[model samples]
Target chain A: MKNSNENKFLSPGHNACAGCGQLSAAQAVMRGLNENIIIANATGCLEVTTTAYPQSAWGLPWIHSLFENAAAVASGILASLKQKGDKKTKVVVQAGDGGTFDIGLGLISGMWERGENILYICYDTEAYSNTGIQASGSTPYGASTTTTPDGSASIGSTQGKKDMLAIALAHGVKYVAQTTTGFPDDITNKVKKALSVEGPSYIQILCPCIPGWKINNDQAVMMGKSAVQTALYPLLEYSDGQLISSSLKKGFQARPAGEYLKNQGRFKHLKDKDISLIEKLAQANIDKYKI
Target chain B: MKNEKVSLITKPNTTLANKTGAWRTAKPMTDLLTCIGCSLCAKICPEGCIVMGEISESAANGKKLKPKNKKLKPKTDYNYCKGCGLCTHECLVKAIKMIKDY
Candidate 1:
């Protein structure tokens, strides 16, 4: 029996914006998975775009719940699979940073605490991209968003990005990694590795949003690379509470944070002083990661 | 029972009926001669409309071209492409151009 669809997972013809970094990264994530998996997706950009009424882009057994309940939903799915004594079918959760870091944090922590064999992927756009670019818990400092608009009297996004990796580690997740849309191969490899590990695993991917970041449609890939090169968000991996590998270890000399900040309209209002302040954040990452 | 309806569940990959290509104001065209066939365009395409196709006489006007890096060239499905120009902008050899769609 032959299926008519050619795409193995997230299919084409979905209504996501052109050059969407999140969707592109999703393709990479899908590339790493086989047919033996079920995905519980949160209510966010990925969900709304793919699963419009009477149409779905997903080519797998996917379930969508409320924004804050994807982790909880996955837990239920895991329980069902356990009851059926099914070991081959993997359970996965997909969420935007808004869901993972803010709305769904409690449910995610509970899922992690139970030590379930689930792979949770967070597409970190840094802001609430689907909700008109509002400030999310993952939103970095000095970046303008709808809620954190930069003005003559103020800088954008007063709060720094929440350290999600530390929080995941604190929960004792077996595998944790971070990558960007720029490195699709790395994203796929990390996903494969995470799935191989037992128990809960977390992979955070920095996905640039076109309108949210005030970037040209074609610039998403470039901006994704720049984010990594600047050390604002470096490619990282942690296994069993130990720093295992990083992009810096692969001989990437960190570029200045200003180079990354200058490209986006979100950071256009930042002066040299403001940029240097942001640089301190990058420096802190470099120091903390021992890169 | 034959007329029973499934509730709250849609068929998989039914979004294929939604031709998002109509939203494009521009379209990407690749120069076969200059293309290195890195397949980055196909890899990065959000629409997943770009597929790497083998270069044959039917594609190259009866002249065989030597492979520079890869043998396959990107063939875009305009019915789904939104003309994001990611291919044109990210082409390593500057082979793709964004032409206004008619």
Candidate 2:
């Protein structure tokens, strides 16, 4: 779409965390989209920020649904658009990790399985960020949350995040990618590319949340960049059943998952062995990608 | 204006966004992984500040994903940069910048 300031985009007054990665991601998305598209945000941070009753921050035709059913809502949007012959406008589903990785996983999978023509972007901050900093399915192992706090007995989030791109790829969809708030260009470029693609596309973003992870607000962006640079989150894409190119191929220095943990009070109680174990997690990521 | 080397993204209503630059300058960031080799960033650039040339063609996606190391190795036309971080913010992967230098 032609760039124009007059075209209404993200509305004002919606409360999002200052320097919020999701907002940055959302802004990047606006840059990629044509400005005429409608977004269906899940009942997470984005929805809460945009549709607070009388005051809404969204600049487009937006809908907010339950935590786990944004995909269904987007599907309905596509189906309704098709029924009305509204071909010019595209529909987008925006959800958080809680909505996508946890509660909404089944519906999201179903939507992709059906080859729904829409863009579903998951802002995976790795937890249920809006609701009291709880753990979600995507929460990394050993990172503490309200419920998964480090203690004498357990490693926080024992399992690793559900592999989203693989999940999307498994659905046999047209396009899928793993992205992060770390690189704005990478995020926008992918969004633009996905917009151009005709079939269903899933963009899984490794968004960082200050409060949820108990990280310093200033560290949010840096942490995002760290995740990608450290090989903890590799930037890759899959298309037509083939693994394509990767981003930042020069690769990055491996930072400690402890570095990611130290900033947040969540992992404050972690013992040295716990830190070492998390370090192993980081090493495993590097080994898996062979970086 | 003195710090030409840094990024500066103002709040809305001050400058240009992808759709709302009626009275401001908002630049875009390019997320490397998310970029799909579309020339939209270059095309949308009002001042040719974006060197789409840096976009890497990943060995994986033969025709997709642009040049790599854009952040550390970009050749921007700063006179044309306009202090609008539309390119930085527009990036799906969040790679562009309108920030002032530290």
TM-score of each: 0.95, 0.71
Q: For residues A104-141, what per-residue lDDT tens digits would candidate 1 score against the true structure?
A: 99999999999999999999999999989999999998
What is the alpha-carbon lDDT for the whole of candidate 1? Answer: 0.89
lDDT of 2 at B100: 42
Two-chain DockQ for each candidate model = 0.51, 0.04
Question: Reference contacts recovered by each candidate, as fractions?
Answer: 0.62, 0.00
DockQ of 1: 0.51
Please give the range of 10 consecutive residues that has the lowest summed lDDT in model 2 chain B: B14-23
Which of the numbered candidates is closest to the native, going by highest DockQ?
1
In model 2, the Cα lDDT at residue A131 comes to: 86
